[model samples]
Target: LIADEYIKMSDGTYPVLFVANKGRNVLLGREAVMRKEKMQTNQIVKDDELFERLRALRRKLAQEQGVPPFVVFSDETLREMSGKVPLT
Candidate 1:
C-alpha cells in the first residue's frame, strides 16, 4: 500500500508499490515493476543480528557519555558496518 519513488529517475519519479507480505520485495525502475525473484534473507538476518549488537554497544556507550545512541554512531553507519563486517 506504500507508494513512493524508491529510486532516482532522470525523467521523473514514479510511485512504487511495496508488497504487503513480502517486505520490500517490489522492484521499481526503468526496466519494469515487479517483485524481486531472489531474496537473501539469511544474509539479511545475519546483518540484522550484527546491527542489533552494534546498536546495543552504541546505547551502552551513549549512556556512559550522556548522549544519544545516534551520536555514537548513526543507524545507517551501523547497518553498513554489520553488512560489511570489517575484520580490522
Candidate 2:
C-alpha cells in the first residue's frame, strides 16, 4: 500500500510499502489512479449494448429508490461494471 504523510526533514514525503516489499511498480496518488481508471472506462462505455443496458438499469433502480440516475450510479461506475461483465 502507498502511505501518504508529511516528512519532518527535507523534500516532504512519506513512503510507499511496495519497494520495500519487492513490488516493482509504484502507482502514486489517488487522483492519478482515478485519472487512469477514467481512461480505461472510456473504452468500456463505448460498447452500445452494455451502455444501453446499464442506462436502462440505472433508470429503473433510480425510479425505484426515488432518486436520479446519477445518484444511483455514475456513468463511469456503470461502465466499469459493464467492462467486468457477468460479475460474480
Winning candidate number (lDDT):
1
Q: Compute each candidate's TM-score over C-alphas.
A: 0.45, 0.48
lDDT of 2 by residue, 7-85 (tens): 1223337633324221222233323222234343236354669878989999999999999999999987887787777
lDDT tens string, model 1, 1-88? Answer: 2344443323337654434433334433334356658865533434777888999999999999999998999987887788886678
The local distance difference test score of model 1 is 0.67
lDDT of 2: 0.62
In candidate 1, list every pair of residues with a backbone clash.
none
Clashing pairs in 2: none
Off by over 4 Å in 1: 1-46
Least well predicted 10-residue stretch by lDDT in candidate 2: 17-26
